[model samples]
Target chain A: MNALWKVARFTATDIFRSKWLPVYTVFFFLIAEGLFRFSGDSGQALVSLTNITILLIPAASIIYGALYFYGAREFIELLLAQPVGRKPLFTGLFSGIAGALGGGFLIGTGLPCLLHGTADDRITILAILSIGVMLTLIFVALALLVAVRSDEKVRGVGICLGLWLAFAILYDGLIWLVLALFADYPLERAAIVMTTLNPIDLGRVGIMLRLDIAALMGYTGAVFEQFFGSRVGFTLTSGAMLAWIVAPFMLALRSFSRKDF
Target chain B: MPPHDMGRHCSSLEMMSAAAGQILRLLLLFSICFACMRTSAVHAAEVRVGNGVDFAAAVAKAAAGDRIIVPNGVHTAIDVKIDKPLEITGQAGATLDGKGKSQILIISAGNVVIRGLTFIRSGMSYVSDNAAIKATGISDLKIENCSFRDNFFGIYLAKSSNCIVRNCSFKASGRLESSSGNGIHQWYCRNSVIENNTIAGHRDGIYLEFSRNAIIRGNKSLNNIRYGLHFMFSDSCAYRDNLFQENGAGVAVMYSKFITMTGNIFRQNWGPAAYGLLLKEIADSHIERNRIEGNTTGLYADGCNRNTIHFNTFHRNGWGVKIYANSSQNNFKDNNFLSNTFAVSTNSSSLQTNVFDANYWSEYTGYDLNRDGFGDAAHHPVRLFTILIERQPTSLILLRSLFIDLLDAAERALPVLTPQTLADAHPRMKPKQ
Candidate 1:
């Protein structure tokens, strides 16, 4: 635990100095502030919040998290040689990076909710922050997995970006193709299974529906409502998320534990 | 001498009676055989055409039990309406081309089965529900292994019962929000099984309104303008093994009761109103073992009550799980809240009778030093800032601000104003099965 704490402290301090983290945070804050100011109506503002959190925030987090994991591998190797167990070191690194992300998310998005938000928007604001932090952790775990598995940073980053693109763009396209070709089969069942593999999309639904935008989106919204709109599916979905957390961490630990750092 | 003569006479009389009985039996058998032959002759009117059949003429001349099997070819603009029980098999995989004008066929009768046919280019209609095949008030009807493309509605059922639609596909390219109809739509239908179907490129992938006791499983609803699946006032139904992704919204369940949604996936359904699932006024439901991921909003429950949400995953969604205003007495247990932004959120100010226990949250920081594998203290999960952010989305900028964090810490210390009943009384350090 002590070794883990030391590594966490070290990574936290190191991350604090990285220009990318602050630049993203500053950019997020500016965009968020602009959205709040420009979206004149309450309904429009809430919609903008959903877009920022789901689209902008996760997009930014994935890029940075992937960059950080590959960029700091050499430094991580140096710490690994200092007689510390790899598990604690990995945990420390994860926690430190996650903490930095959480802090950055708070600074980028949470500050606006605190200073200028109304009572009506509080739950959504908090939901956005909670979702932002969790998403950062998930991406960080994924990025670390990519980094540890591959020898070259370029390959790791390529894999990570490819994964993001497949989930963000290509998976949906494939789903459409299947639906188009096999009109006689029950493809919706397959489509649902495919979407859960992507974490970014999962986090978006988990947060926005809580704010009650289903009235606008209609039947497609109803599909999600049937799954996550209730306390029943909500708990199940949360459990799946917990699995995501432990599974990746375990994989990373296994790879790090055996690697000749 | 007299007794021997009487015995001989009795034996002769018995022989004569046996002969007479055999003759009567033969006559009766012949008459029955003649009647059976007449019945078979009267019903032998079936016409089988390999290339194609003039459906209009066939229906006029066909008997109730006769079949008009269409052979492999493209048939055009045929609106054959069934008025009696018959088998219409498309032989060697025939295609019924609508020529982009009107419906292919309409079934208004019972005990009909249409199988192994491909329908393309249905006629567009604004005032009426046009489809490649439509069944209205038809009972004991089965449509299987059929495909519908460029139709207003692929297969539409209204006021129909005891119908089974299996292995069907509905693809619509005419995706205008004003007129693009659903892929598979049913209303006021009962005991229908819509299974193993792929529905896409329309307004709704699958829609059920006021339809009850329907089994919808093994279907993929994708890239529609609207919902993957939509249910309103639809009760006593089970939707299992379905996928809802990248539609305008994922799945919407509203004003429905006694619904069991299990083993489904909801993901990548984006937009402000997008959610893995949206529940409003849904009561007494079971949502279990479903994976909800990568949507704008996951599991938004508003005013839904007496539901059990267990064993599901909420990962990488914009917002994880939310219990909105006027929702009460719901049980959320044995679920994992992994890395979601907010594990739980509520708008109730007082007791709402919601239980959030035994949930494993990745963000949980508490310890179980005794190794009992449970958290020593209750994890005060609902942050005050969460409550504030629910009401004021713009206030999120103040997160981690000294004032906001202090306020959150204060709320954790003193539990007041937030819903008192909404808590994890026995928060688990690990996920419960």
Candidate 2:
């Protein structure tokens, strides 16, 4: 535990010294504050903030995770040469990245909402904050997994970009195509299960349900309420979200522990 | 009509000799007229009752046209019946508690007046509609300035005409739909005026079934379990300047004619089956100058015809207005549909019979090059996405997605799925209001 904290503390401070963390934090703060100031209603501002954060957090976290891991190849090799166990080193490094990104997100968006939001806006704000941090953790873990599996730098970046595009855009397009083709079938619960397969879609569904705008979806909204708004549905969604964070990080940890570097 | 008339109504006179009964009936009519004349000649008697006496005892002892004054205390009464024409007034802080077991007051005569009473806990039962006050088969009944708490029904009027229920507040906290009742429930009533009542947390705020010519004005119905106001099988009703907010299904008007709903505000009634106004099988109505905002669907028209919807503002609703194919010959003129998700969607309509002219849609992107108020290009309110969702309920998962917007744009350019003739011909460049 002591060695793990030492490695984690060292990695966090090293990243903190860079200017990109401050830039990302300031960007999030400015957007949240601007939305709060301009949107006449705070509830509306919270909704817009959730929409933007879900989109940006995954993309930014993926790119940053890939670039930082590839850029520190020599440092990782030097640390591995020391008297450190591979499991602690990998866990420590993963925690550092997850902690830095998630902490930055919560502080950036949470502070502004807590200051300007109304009493009823607290639960929604907290949910939005957690979703943002979860996306950051999930994407960073996926990027690290890609980085650990591949050796070529350019190919790793390409794979990360493709993963981001697939999850962020093409997945929804495929779902739409499936819906259009089978426009007559009863695929209600099937579509929701597909939504849980992708982390970005999970975040979008969570925020949309909170906004109470799912009713605008007509029949789909009712089905969503039935499946995702029940206690069992709530538990399943939270379990799926936790699985998204755990599965990718564990794979990346195992691969890093056994890698020849 | 007094104690004598009461005795006559309660008596079984079928065994009386025919000749003798004829002469007695003539004498009884003459005596009633003489008694009315004498009561008019003298001042109406006033009785101070119900401080320590029983409330039913007070009603039984009072004569017709007498004024009974109830003092400031709790009157625990069970099934008190008012059978004579009497004016009953309660002092400030006077209460009628039903003890969670029985109905409170039942008015059975004409020319009855009730005011300034607080009714509490008339109980809940499945067998009957337990109410704080119930008026049946009476003419010219008035209930004013009363407050009701936790009663199954606040004020129930059945087969009564020329009644006025004004300035009363009703509050019930029953959560389930079957467990609660309406605040003001009227059936088979005519020429009734219900004004300035505030109601909350009931099954429905006001329900008028088989009632006609009811003028409901300046009432606020908020946060009820079902509709704010629901009326069916009634005709010639006017609702003016009322505010309904956050009810389960907003308001429903079904199987009615000549409904003049004007200057009402409906906001934020959002649920799966909720709408700002649900109009079914209604015809020849004038709905004007209303503001509907933030509902799931602003107005839903099914089998509605010959209605004029003019000068209303529907702002930021799920669908501004949804019309079934059976709804025809309705005129939508000079209304502002602003920022709704789907402006107007139809099941499968050519819209050949209905008219959509001079309406401003916030999503309309056409320009007025001629400097006229109308746009040169026609604006079709039915988007292709609505049709897709209608075809497959699962496609609703793609709502608010970027690809759906692309699909809508592509379909707009080609005009494939959406009906071409369902459009606003003279789309206004700006809102009228």
Candidate 3:
């Protein structure tokens, strides 16, 4: 436990002192602030602003987490050479990164929402932070995995970018193609499966649904409406999203533990 | 022998009489056929009538199912009343000149088919719904391959069901606000299909009120005075594969239910009050597969519930999605948020009964080292910066300021005020693969 604390302390210290992390965090904050200000009285404007902020903050958090994880790995390796076990070292590194990310999130996004928010917006504000926290943990875990897997920085960044492209662009294009080619058959079933598989979309949809702009999210939620337009279907979709959150997390954790690195 | 021969002559006489009767019948048939041919030749629906008999008079003489073939030419006329089901076929280049006085055609009968006619310069009336073609109480009415220019409502469908308007173009006259007309207006109608039409320069490209079970597909609507497609009190309608661009308020889906909008493009719709698709008092609707780009607000949804938004791309919009208060029980999933100024914003955040899950946000900065492809933790999307921006519009000038950036970083470190409820329970490490 003491060794774990040391590892966590080391990670937190490194992240806290990093020059670039703050820059990125602040950059995200500014954009989020700008969007919130410009977002108007219309439901569309408000939803759009929230969506944009959600997208950007996670991206920023993930990127920073990746870099921080790798950067902190070298220090951990040195510590390992001294006498620390792999588990303690790894746990400490993750804890430290997670803490730093959590801190960055609170400072960059949480504070502003609190200071300027209405009594009614309290839940939305909490939702925003919750998303940020989840993303911070996710990135921390992912960064650790990447750091353990490869010594080369390029590969790690490449892998992350490739994943982003697939989730953001290729997946939807594929869904569209399938839908067009199989017009005779119902694609809603297939679409729901695909959506659950895409965690990014899951997160986005989950957050937007909470914000009550799911109606405007459009096609993303159509699959649920098709089978789940009924009460039973709605409950099923809700359950499916909940499963999406849990299943992937478990899988990621298992992979992290078993990875050779 | 003489008697028998006389009997044979009588029998032959009877046969001859029978042959005479058959010949008379044949002659009658031949005369009828000849008259039909002559009638067709005289009023050849394909014959150009620019200098010929009055087109209206020719139409009056047309038979119940004959073609009023207007050949490739121009004719100036007013008010061609169609009381019967007839094919009014115009040659490839034919034009009808309305002379800017009255409606070009008024169809009040069933199964009327109007095709391949270019109507120009119809009179505009503020008091009357003067249209190039006004179809009322008509069933199976088809208006195809036609053009209406400088008219009030190009084609009006009133209490008409199963009416099809396809491959048509409308350019409504730039009249004053009260005088401006809708491109295609349908009221109290059902089972109508408006497909593959281009409409511009009017209060609304397509307006449907109290209509139901309609399909608006494959249309291009642009530069309208109010909305590209405006609907009120409509239900069970589907809009797909359409483009709404550069319009005043884009498209307003208001006071409606059970609508499905898919595979449409909403772009360049700019104005203070502009939105790509607006939802008010909408329920049990499915809005999917739309490309909402470069609009003031990609989607503005309020007073809505039990709707699903999925698989959409919101790119480079001024504001991507807005949620007003009094909206609940909706779901947003599997969407792509790319390079928008504001992705999602909402008021009445306490009513946090909505769900947003499994969407790809370009701003997501997470990793999926495990190949299972999910972020290890939750992601809080609402930031203090966004909240500040929502509260203070003028504070946007400080967007790039170092102090604001520092403050944002501080907030991220320890979330204090941002909505605790605004988060993805599971944010994907990457987008969907």
Candidate 4:
């Protein structure tokens, strides 16, 4: 455990000091500041910021995670040459990248919202930032899984970008098609279940409910409120998000452990 | 009797005269007492109801045009059915406790008046819809200066006409939506006036169903479980100067026509399915000079047609106006759309048949080169991003991002993706002050 912590801290320091992390942080800061200063209302600014966080954070995590894994291949191999086990090395690498990205997101968006946001805006901002961080973790794990499965870096990056595009954009289109085709049926419960299949939709709906704009969604929004508005629903959705983060990383670790260098 | 006979005859005559005088005096006294009783009975116009008198019995015994005055105390559960035209007045601090078993007062007769009473704890029954005061099939009934607390339905008027409910307060202790009833609920009534009422915590503060020609004004409805005021299939009604605040879904007017809604303030009705006003399948209405603020959606219209919406202020809401695709032939003019997330969002991309003209949009950036207070260039209120979000609500997370904003700007400049006919031809350069 101590060795694992040491390795993780070393990897986290490397990623934290890298130029990309600072760039990512600055991007978030500039967007948050622009929205806070330009948008006349804090609620509108919060909504805009939530949008940016959901779209950009996952893309950034995927690209950064895959690139980092490829760049640190030599270091990983050198550590594998040491007596360090595969499990700890994989765990250390995963934690380090996820922590750096999550930390960058928090400091970048969370600080500005806290400083400029009103008392009523705090809970919504917190919810948006938390979901962003969770998305970062989930996507980073998925990227690592892609990277470990392929030996070629280009193929790995392609796969990660594709996954990001699928989750962020294409998945919604498919859901729309499903809803439109089955419009005659009572599909609210089924629609809610479908939304849970995608982490992004879950996060979006979760934050939207917090922002009190789900009313515009009509019947599906009402169903979501009944499920995601309650304490048990909140726990279940949050637990599902956590599972989204854990399951992919676990699969990646198992694959990475068995693979020959 | 010889000497005693003459004395006896004089004594007997004197005794007989005395007896006759006594009988005459007694008969006169008896006639006077009978006359006084007759006059008192004839002059009994006011009935005082207290001091161990049952309220229901008093109402039953009172004749037409009689006044029943209730003293200051808590009365027992009253299921009184009024059949005669009478006035029931309660003094200060008089309360009718329904004991959570039945309705407090049920008026079945015409020309009845009820005033100055507090009703409490009417029972909850889905079958009966127990109320504090229920007026059925009556006319010229006036209820004033009453307070209702913890009742299922506050004042229910059914199949009645030409009634007035004013200066009353209704409060319900409803923990859930299904268990609660409306504050002033009217069904199948006509030509009624509901004014100067303050209502809270009911299902809907005021609900009118199949009722026509109602003049609803000067009411403050707040914090209800459902809508503040819900009108369904009620035609030719006018609502003015009413304030609806913090209700679950604000006011909903559905399947109604010829509604004149003006000068009403709708505020702080924030929720997922909430709107400042929801017009569903409504037509031929005039909505003007209303202030809508801090709601999720200021005005949501679904299948609403031929309405004239003008001079209303839509401020600080998620969506200012969300007109569905099915709605058409509506005119939106001279309205100020200020600082909402989406100014106007519609589902269809086809040319909208409705008109959006001479409106002040805070998001408009066109220069008024001619200085006519209207912009030279037309303004497109629908953004491509709004369209995307409408189709896929999950895409809402991409709101206000730079890419989406750029896409919206490009769409605005080129008019390629957005509906071509949905532009405001005479967009105001500045908001109306």
lDDT of 4 by residue, B1-433 (tens): 1344554557787766766777677666775888633232233488888766778878877877788898888887567788878888999998999999989888898888899999998888888888888999999899999999999999999999999999999988797888988899999999999999999999999999999999999999999999999999999999999999999888899999999999999988877778899999999999999999878788999999999999999987777899998999999999988767788888888879989999988777788887999999988898887787676564454434344565677787777667878889999876666
In terms of TM-score, the best-performing candidate is 2
lDDT string for model 1 (A119-152, tens) is 8677777777877777777777877777788878
Instruction: Name the 10 consecutive residues with the lowest summed lDDT in model 2 chain A.
Output: A210-219
At residue B255, give the lDDT of candidate 2: 99
**Candidate 2 C-alpha lDDT tens digits along A1-261:** 877898788777777888777778888899999988865456557756876787789988888888888987988898899988888887787778778877888888988998898886777887799889989999999999999999888999999999988888788899987776876687887799888898888887777666656244355677787787789988998899999989999999889988997
Candidate 3 per-residue lDDT, tens place, A1-261, comes to 899898788677776676655865686567556555643222333344455544554455556656766666656556757876766666676777777767776777765565556675676666667656655565555555555565687788777666555654456556545655665575556666665565455444444444433232233233343443457754665566556445544554455456554
lDDT score of residue B145 within candidate 4: 96
DockQ, model 3, C-alpha based: 0.02
Q: Sort by DockQ, best first: what order?
A: 2, 4, 1, 3
Candidate 1 per-residue lDDT, tens place, B118-207, comes to: 888777888778888788887888988888878888888989998999998888876676688888889999999989998889888998
In order, what lDDT does every prediction score?
Answer: 0.73, 0.85, 0.70, 0.85
After superposing candidate 3, which stretches have Cα over 4 Å from the reference? Answer: A1-261, B1-51, B173-176, B410-417
Each candidate's chain A: what TM-score?
0.87, 0.96, 0.76, 0.96
State the lDDT of candidate 3 residue by residue for B1-433, as single tens digits.
2345545667777766766776677666775878643333223254235556667876787766667778777776688898877788888888888887888888888878889999887677867888888888878899899988888778889999999999999987584657778899999998999999999998899999999999999999999988999999999999999999988778998899999999999987765578888899999999898999877678888899999998888876656788775778788887777656567777644537777788766556566666665565555566565566565332332232233445666887787766566666666554443
Positional deviation of residue A127's Cα in model 3 after best superposition, in angstroms: 36
- Evaluated at residue B40, the lDDT of candidate 3 is 30
